[model samples]
Every structure is written in C-alpha cells, then in structure tokens.
Target: MSAYSASPSTPRTTSRTPTPPRTTVVNVEEFEMDGRSIETKSADHVPIVFKANPFKHTYPILRHTCFGVQGKQTCEVRDTTTNPMFRDMEEDDPQIQYVAKPFRSKSVQKPYRLRCGVMNYAWGKQSTDSAVAQWMQEGDPTYQVEQRPYAELWVGTHTNAPSYMQESTGSSSNLVSENSSFANQSLHEFLQRNPATLGDAHTEQFGTDLPYLLKILSVATALSIQAHPEKSHAERLHASDPDHYPDPNHKPEAVVALSNYKAMCSFRPLPEIAHHLQTIDELRALVHEDMVERFVTVVGSDGSSVEAKKEALKSIYMELLLCDSARVQQSIDAMTARLRNSTDLSWVESTFLDLTVQYPGDGGCFQVFFLNLIELKPGEGLFLAANEPHAYIHGDAVEIMARSDNVVRAGLTPKFKDHKVMGEMLSYDTQPLHIFRPNNEGPLTSYCPPPEYPDFKLLRVSLTEEWPGVSYELGKSSGCLLVTQGSATLLYCGKDCTIPTARLEVSVGSAYFLPSRLSVYFSRMTDFVAFIGECQIRAG
Candidate 1:
C-alpha cells in the first residue's frame, strides 16, 4: 500500500521529447464488440516551454502554444481549487499575430481496458465462490491460481490497491502503476494531468483526485463491526495515527448485491433492544442494574422527551460496551446456558450460534442485537452514511464509496479495535435501513440515477439487443465498467456520438475504464449485465 498526499503545486512544464517536438499517437482502447471493431483516437498536440521565438511554430494541433517569449507563462497549476490558470495567452511579438490557446482546457483523458489489483484479506471467499477471483481469471486468460482467499477487486485511484491502465499494441501489453509503466505514472498521476475527466465542478470540489473508490467484495466470514468517521474525525485520526488512519476523508459506502447478501447495519428500535437486555441474562448481568432500569424506563415511558430518550439510550449503551470483561464473560456463560432453554431467537441469538462456531466466545457474537439484520437477494443495494456502523455478514457485492478508508472497528475481528474512537464516531439514533435498487426510466434504458452517494454514482445495467438505442457520455469524465455476466458489444462512438469509433468485446469479468471526453453507446449488448462505477461531474 502506498501513502501519497502531495500538496498541489504548479508543476514545472516538462517535455516528452526534445525542443523540435516529435509527434506520436497512443492507442487509448481497442476491442471487438459483437462482430464489429471500434476504436478511439488521441494525439500528442504541442509542448509548452518558456522560450523566445513566438513566430516560429514547430509543433502542430493547436495553432499557437501558451508560452511564447517574455517569461510570462500562466503555469500556476497549484491554484486549481481557487483560480486555475486555464486560458490562452496573447502574442505580443509583431512578427506574428494569432490567438495562443493553452492546452490545459482541452480534455486529454483517454478510456482504456483497466488492469485492477486484488486485495486478499483473510476474510475472503474461496477461489470458486469468489467474485474477485472469477474476474481476475477473465481479465487474464493465462492467469491460473491455486486456491486462495479472494477478497476485493479494486479499480480506482486509491493509494491502496490502485488500478492501472492496460495498454496493448498487437500482442504486447503494457501496464501503468506506481512503479510506473507506459506513461511512467499511476492512475492518480493520470487524473492530475487530465482534471477535465472530473469536470470543472468536481475539479473545484475535490481537485484533480477521483473522489470515489470502486470495489468488488467477496466475503466468506463477517467483516469487523465498524463505523466510518466523518471528515473532521477522519482528519483527526489520520493526524494522530498515520499508520492506522491512512487518509483524511470521510467514507460513505453503497453496496450492491452480486449474490445473496446479509448484513447488520445501523440500530434497531429502542423497544427491541430493551427486550434483549431484559430477556438475555448475560446482557442484564453485564449492564448495571440502574442503567438497565433507566433504559427500560425510557423505552416504556410515555412522557419522555426525544433528548431524554436519546440520552437514556447512549448512557445505557456506554455502560454496557465498557463493562469489565471477566465478569461480562461469566454473565455470557450463564446466558449461554439460558439460550439452551429459550425458544424464540433474535439476530443476537442466531448470529451468536453461528459466530461462536467460527470465532468461539468472541464478544461480537452477541452484538447482533444492537444492529439491524438485513437479507438481500441479487441486485439489491444498501447505503451506509458516515458514522453508521455496519458489518458484512455474508455475500458477494460490488461496493463503491468515497475515496477513504477511515474505519473505527469495535469487534468481530482480531484487528485493532478502538472503542473510544468508535464510540465518539458512531451514531446511536438510526431507523431501519433498506437497500437501494435502480428505478426504471424510459428511452435511456441503460442509465440509472440519483445515486445515494454524493461523491460517486453507480448502477447495474442488464443491456440486451432488443432495447432501443441508449447513449451514455463517458467522453467528459472518467468511470469504470465491469461486465459481470454474458458477452456484450460496446459501440465506441466519435466526438459527436454520431459515428462508430471502435467495438470493444466485453465478456464476463471484462472491465473497461471510460476515458474522459469520449461518449459511446452499448448499441447492441447481448444480455450483458455490468456494473458501471462513475461520479457525476457537473459542467462549468
């Protein structure tokens, strides 16, 4: 994992070649869609340098370069957030009178088939059952692996498991990474050069960075019982411990089920929790009597104000979570005996039995009562706001979130558990949470909108040949599209979205990075089911 938080700067102008510029073309993306061939074009225009001769123009594309003589080049890239220097420079030399345009405003990002890296955390599913493993196999036909835990397939500009562009010239393939390949840089570097991919709105809001992380998670065991801190808390944590809290950004995640999914998210009703504290001897014994009584009183009270009720809940919970462990376990053992006699089972009971078999007497086995238990079929989704605690119990999912990994784990894992931080960040008041699914819209058959997250947007598209022609503008911003099932034909169109440029073959596990400033239509998809991860970039 790499940690890079570079303060923005007015990067010095560099050249790909010597002064008398040499021109070269880079193949952005090329693939077969259905039976047709499609492709897009990008050319290196001109190089900028603080030089004398304004009249002599060696390089082409733009009529005039921004930098002429006089050493007055507008190269303040550091002021991207406030006042970006993205304008043309006027030529003062009497020898030539022409409009000199800066290359900064022109969209330079190109879409490509991306090569993503995988995270193999211990809580992953086996090779056959893992969605990430399946995709890896598809991404590389020669890739064959012995059995291993496959956790996450990450495709984004995140410092951890950052993705790379797949460049192909006939049989030879090139990959770009932190070690640097092709363009000699990482995805983050690419974004820095082409801020237009995020558009002017996102460029101003989030700078040149991609504000979201795209991931495919395949979990066999439960993830940690954790809550993501808001921006301020994240900043504080990162400032305190750079090792644990790597980034200083809030994380709000959206999970879409690729398989049968189960999770524990948010808090259940007050009455249901009080019942657990009453009926479960372990919980009652662990919590102080006065605290329990006050909780029960609040739950049963008719004339209690909202503030009083909230305080009652928090007060009781703090006591319970911070209870002495030796005595708490003794109470838990007694409660284990009581569970043998009980008939009805809550999430706490059912999950406790299953977890104890997996973890054996870990405290989180009983934490199920505090959070809502959710079950979702394929295509269902869930959105977790910052500070909302959640644990993925079982399932495969395509998850997207703000480009941050600021977790305060409390239980359900052997990893670091910071209850103090967790307590401060976690929100006690919550309603029963539900998964978000895409709604149907007309004509534009493939598009889905109003993504739950403010940073990034996503939708699962099951396109077929029968639907009326639908178009999406990937030409302006960057995005990731991973084909999950069947084969699809993507019609890569030209600048105006009028002519066919290239046909990319999208098969199961085939993932493509949508370039900035290139729009295309999945003109004819053959029962193609894919997840497209992209952020909304409002035009200036």
Candidate 2:
C-alpha cells in the first residue's frame, strides 16, 4: 500500500489527447434500464470508474440478536449489593450476535451493495437469499472484474489501510481492520502490519500508526450509559489490573450523525442532578448525607455539574456496594418502584421505567438520572475527550477519534462494571463538551459534518443535479472521494479517465489514495453525494 505523497503543483505529464468534435455526434448505444435500451441526450456524460478498486470497505450490517444467551452474557464484575449491569447492551458481548456478516463472502455480484468505493451495508440491500448468494460473488475470483467501474471515481491507499485476506492472497488489500476480517488478530498487531497507508516521511516522523481512528456507526439500538478514563489515570490502572484495564491508554471519541442521532452526554449540573435526585423518594435509602454534602459542595456556582456528580457518585457507589445481593436488590427494587408511581416528574417515571424493562436486573438503570440527554439531526456531531461520560441512545453516525481502543466502563454493562476502577481512571476536572454543526442544512449535513479529527478531515460533495462544482487542492495529504448516488467523473491529469459502475463503485466507498500530489475532479449525476476525507499523506 502507498502512503500519501507531497503535492506536485505540476504533475508528470502523460501523452493522450481527445479527438475533435464531429458535426453530429453518433449514439454509441441506447442506455440500458430494466434490461431495455433507453434513449440518451446527444452529449452523454460518462460517470467515474476505478481499476482494482482500493478503498478498504465492508458492508457488515450489524443487527441485534441480544435477547437469547445469558451464559455467554458478560458477567458483572462490580461488588455491588446487586449486579445491575446488563450484557445485552455491551458492544463486545459474546452472545450478542450481529445479523449480517459483510466480510465473509468475497464475490462482487452486486455493485451498489458496496457503497463509497468500499463495501458497506447500511439499509437492507440483501433481500432475497438468491441476491445474498449472488452478491457474495465479489469474493470469487471466477467473476469478471472491470476497469473504471464508475465515472469520476477514485480508489487507492491512505494512512489507515485495511487488512487483506491472508493465507489466500499472501498480500493484504487496501482496507481497515474490521471485526469480521480480524476476529483473531490483535487490534495493535493489525495496526502494526497495515501502518495507515501514509508517506515514508510520516512513517518516520509519527511512526506507522496515526494518532486517530475513524468509524462509520449504525446504531440499531440504544447504547448503555458510559464514559472513558483520562490518559495518565488509565495507564496506572492498567498496570494495577491488566485483566480489567485491557489497554494502556484512554479513549476519547467524536460522533457525527449520518442519520438522526440521539444521546445522553454529561449529567445536568449538580443543582439539576440534585433537583432530580430530591424528587426521588428512594434517595435516602440509596445514598448517604456525606455523599449529598460532597455533591452540594462541588455544584458550586460555576455551573459545571460533571465534576461534582462524578465525585459524589464514587461515594454513593461505595456505600451501595457494601451490602450483598439481597440488600442491593431491595434498594434497586425500591428505586424502580418509586419511578413507576411518581407523577411529580414524568421524565423520571417514564425514562426510568423504560430502562427497567429494557435492562431488567442491571444497576446502570440509575445512570439515566445523571446524564445530559440530546437528539442529533443528520450532520450534527458530539465530541467527548477523555473522562467525559456519554452514550448513544439511538440512530447511526460516522465516528472518529484518536487511534486507541482503551475504554473504561461505569455501570450500564455486566462486564467489568467497576465504578472504583472507572473513577480512578477519570479526569475529575470537567469542561463543557462541544458539538459541531454543518455550514449548510439538509442531507448534505448528514453526508458531512465539520471535520472532527485533526489527523483526518472530511467534506461533502453533492451530485443531485449535473455535477456540483467543488474546488480543492491536494497538498500533502492524499485523499479519496466516495460516490453515494447517481454517478460522477474523475478528470485525471485532464485525460485517460474511465466510467465505473454504480454498484461496482460501492466497494471503493469514502477512501481513495492520491499519488501525484494533486488532481482536479468534475462530476455528472442524477441524485448523489460523496464524502471526502484526508488520506495519510506527507511530503516525499
């Protein structure tokens, strides 16, 4: 895989010229739709295409089958009176199986199934069993592969390269490390081998891996309330208990809405949390005055509720955890019962009861009272640096963050639900979390939010009409353009361009490599959009 190269204001020249226009253009052939020939205009536009598409893509549409298996459910690690954490909501829960496995089969039978020059399954594209079998054909070498699958298309390597199917090709393809592809591979090992398709200089400077990782998320269901530790604190905890703190670093993430997004971020200020806490008659039974006093002290006039809530939480948690199963269950039952009957605050009754039914015997049911609830429209995004507690409630989005998988959990999960561990790993000093909005409105925002990752940035291009015009200069970072609708054209060095198929182009999705520093792009379409992200590029 090639890393990004420096911009070449003047690219190396190739010698290919187009023929002069004729008085009357001849129709090459009637356009085919529904297996029939449809007439076209005199000047037909050729969409962009790719040869040996390089975008490392997958369409593993994950579905929730979380109700079944309790044995395989993530067991609770907390010493609480009652284990309130649930296994169904955890992402890594073993029994929680994903419905569709996108990376298993290799046959490229269908083109559109692979969105963005890469492979991705968002909304259901696999209906018939026959179609599923046919689409799996891309993995089959026997099927014919073509050059220029779509018009104005791009495909190549970037800093974050995908792991290729090993033992089969001996050489890896340009793609990222997907769970399906590298189920047995360590995330660190995969990064070591692929080394973000970056330039040699960057490889020398920043080492192989980039500081950040990006993800495309489709939330079929709500995520559990959670947060991550700060950097230094995380390192120390991992040293003390390697089994509990898997990685040595902290996790800070940002999510941009690709579809409608919903979440509960930081808890309301102490006054609000205290306000909400007061209305709950079960408060005295669940916590102590010392904890209440500590919370009141921190909820000081500053208006930052996160610090006080987190501090007071550590104390309240230690108290509840002192008892065994029976006592804990009694406390949990009382709180839940209060939520069901209290008409004073509908939010407490409704949200709490909904969680009780959804998670049954889990303690994280209490987290709903302590977070900032929000609904994100398409194109909007949320940024959570280290120690900021957050969770996705519903909807799907594109996620980007520093390239580390280290995470610390507090409640809302059965696996390792250790608040002491989480509290110790966090940065107690709190600040307001920021959200980003698009410069324009509508689906374009859904397509692209303001760039979140400092290492990699993203932009959106619309092709709903003819091709929308966008001016960009490929400086040092190599980049890719992903086509999501109609078709487009890539004018390479001004000539030698080809038309690619819409479905075929799907495999290339949102990633492409820029080799010669810079190239200009133009488009033609019916209704389409493209997401452009910076590739791992550097001065040669």
Candidate 3:
C-alpha cells in the first residue's frame, strides 16, 4: 500500500448544503503557482493542479490535495486525474482542479557555469608555461595563446574585469532553449537583478556587490613592490588622483600556493633588519646616517616600546624612498659589483642580484634586505593586510582579495609610482611572517582568514579515488567554485525530488557560481581538486 493511502470516503451529493466556514491551521510548505497563493483551511479536501511551464522540468510540483480531519492534516491524491500536461502521473490519483494562467519563470537561483576574465601582465609566465594561460585554454577551447605573458585569471564582479555567465543548468528545457539571453550576461548585472543569490544577510552587510575577488596568478618574474592603502587613505587618494588610485576601497589579500611559490611578505623582525642594516654597507648608503643611527638604537634598546620601534623603522624607510635617485642607483650598482665578485653569497644576496638584473637601478631591489623573503610549498598560504608592502616573486598561486585595484607602487615598474604616499601609508611594524595553515577535515580543507578580515574564506575539496563522491552543502551563502584538477559529475537534487534534477559534467578549469542555500553532490572519475571562494557573512 502507498504511504499516502487513507480509508474509503463517501461520494459527493448533487444537492448543495451550506455550512459555516471555520478557520484551522495546518503545517505545510507554501508557494505560489499560476498566480494563486496555496493555503490550508478547515476542509476535507482541496485539490490542486500545477500548470505546465518551463519551470516544470526544473522544479518538482506535485499534484495532490490537503485533507484536514479532526485537527490532523495529510496530503494525498485520492482519485484518478487526466490532463495532457500530466500524462505521466499515476492513473489511480484523484482528479485535480486546473487553474489557467500565463506561464512565467522565476529568477535563476541555482549553480551556473561562468566565463572569467584573464589579465596579461609583464611579470606573468609566457604561453603554456603559465597556469593562468593553461586554465584559460581549458575553460574556453576557442581561446588561443599568444607570445605575450598571461598573468591572472580574475573570477569576480570587479568593474575593471567581470566574469560572465556561460551557461545555466537544470532540467528546464524551455528555459534553456527560449531564455538563452541569460547566457553571456555579466555577473554584476545578474547580481543586481537577483540579490537573493547573495543571501539576504550578505546583501544587507556587503550591499549586493561581491565582497571578494578570486584570482589564479602565474608569476615568472618579480612584480612591483607595492602596498594598498587603508579604506580612509584609499578614498583620499582616489579623490585626489583618480587615475593612479582607481578605486576607493582597501585590498586585504590572502594567497595559497598552487605550486612552489616565492614572495616577499611583510617586514622582517626588528633584530634581523637592524643586523642587516648595520652589516650591509651598500644598503646603508642609501638612507641618511642620522635616521639609520636612530633606527638601530631604537631597535637594539630593550626599553623601546613597539610603537617607538615602528616609528624609527618608518623614519628610515621613508628616508630610503625619498633619497636622491642618483644615490639609490649608485647603491644598486655597488651591491651588484660586490655580489658578482664574492664567491659565497646568502639567499638574500642572490635575490638582490636577481632583482637588480630584472629591474636595474630600481630602489626596490634593496627591499630584499628589509622584507621577509619566504618560499611556500604547495598548500601553504599567507595573508597580507592593507598597508603592508609585498611582492610576488615567482610561481603559481590562488589569490583572494577585496574587490579593488588601488595599488601604490614603490618601484620595479614603469607605471606611476606614489613613493611619498607609499612611505607614509606603510605600517612599518617589523614582525615575523606568520604562515596560514588550513584546518583539514577529511577531503575538505578550510583556509579561514583572521577574524578582523571576515570578508571571505577559501574551502579546498580534494577527492581521491578511494573517496570519489562527496556532498557539499552551501548553507546560506553564495560562492564560486573552480576545478583545478581532474573531472567530476555534479548532481543537484531539488528539495522535493528524490533524484537529481540537474547534472553537470565538469572538467579541469571549469568554474560555477553556486547560489545560496543549495546542496550539490560530486562524483569524481579520478583524483580531483577544486577550490570554493565564499563570503563570510552570517546567515539571518
């Protein structure tokens, strides 16, 4: 017997008899169908028939009636029904009352494929050597790689370069066929129309715009030594010089190594920097003698507070940046000549030579001694706050940051350098580099940022052959997922269906925009790895 089966009922009479209407409350999910609100009342049966439409293929709308008896509510189809739209339904079900209305489809509220944008910077790797180029080729078969370098693959709704919708997935054949205009729409435009995808709490907190931008970077050479301004300073810079400072937003970034990666992070420990300044004659020549003496004295004194040490470091750094250009070049030349003649050189000396070769006579070359030079293995990560000076030296990595592009360059580039602003804005607190280690749980590893930076988090899913399938519940926040390795079959089963209503076959480099509160299952053919970038807003 069926679970919905009930005892036999008497037949209806032709003679009409009026009865007083009474209110009764029953528990059941409510939704609109054919422009009518479905509600339960004090009645034995209220038949319903879902109109056939494009969404019928995507959403599972059942044909049933509510039975309210003795304060109890149950749903069942008590008789057979015949309709051209529902010929596949069971013949024994009760007849349903059909309401005629024009068919209308709801806004998109599910995962869809995305086509991200790519940037070609000079520091990027050339041709297929770059992971960004390779991923671009994999995602778009029509894309052709040229001789120029490919640097970053941007996956967000930043105004400079926004991602577009490639395709939408579901069982809705009419939606896919008739509503083809949804494809190729910018993600920013889509979010404007459908704010629910970002969740109510997120939209309220972050204002409908995506809070973070995800990027895949392939570095072949050293990038410019730069720092991003804080929120207040960014606004001031943008208002004063809009060309150089493109946006009025701070950019706090975190990077996870996809391969062996080398980068210059925050300033080194006070003792280490003081030692280098005292020993390295070439480095000490650029800064003023008085400023260097004060910095060394402050750093060496045990009684000096952290704030005093930071002020002293800032004084020396500013002197170095504001020094005469000819003296900076002469210092670079002296360092190069000495390093070439010396047989034994430390990594710091070797890196200094490399920077001088890449960017000759640029004062940024001396930053190697002042900053912490760190190398990260695969899976290792680092977080850089706003106003902290850093540069990516080489290798591939996944970088996520606030949606902004306001960089104050110090050197190593032909672009406009804001040396004065860069010097004043830097947070010259010399501390050891703290590497972020992900919290691992089975096949999933979460790279959560510090509590102060609650804008975004990264989740990495690694599926091995032994554990080939996993279910991911997105809870109540939207996110973008990119497949970095292998391939998998994704299944999305709606709330009312026992089987999947949408199935997508994804391969390496594929990216999808996942809606809020959606659960998806993945079945892999082989070892697979994917990263999901999501906002950290709390659900309301």
Q: After superposition, how far is residue 220 of candidate 1 from its true place, in Å?
A: 0.5
Tens digits of per-residue lDDT, candidate 2, 40-91, equal 2112332111112111221111122211111111111221122233222334
Q: Which ten residues in a row have the lowest lDDT in candidate 3?
A: 1-10
- lDDT for 260 in candidate 1 is 86
**What C-alpha lDDT values do all the predictions have?**
0.63, 0.43, 0.72
Per-residue lDDT tens digits for candidate 3, residues 334-444, read 878888999999998899899888888888889888889999987788988889999999999998888899999997777888889999999886665657764343556
Clashing pairs in 3: 79-93, 79-94, 80-93
- In order of appearance, the predictions have TM-scores of 0.73, 0.56, 0.77
Residue 266's C-alpha lDDT in candidate 1?
A: 89
Answer with 1 or 2, whichever has the higher lDDT: 1
Question: Which candidate has the highest TM-score of all?
Answer: 3
Best prediction by lDDT: 3
Question: What are the runs in model 2 whose C-alpha is more than 4 Å off?
Answer: 1-162, 165-197, 237-240, 297-328, 335-349, 428-430, 441-463, 471-474, 478-526, 529-540
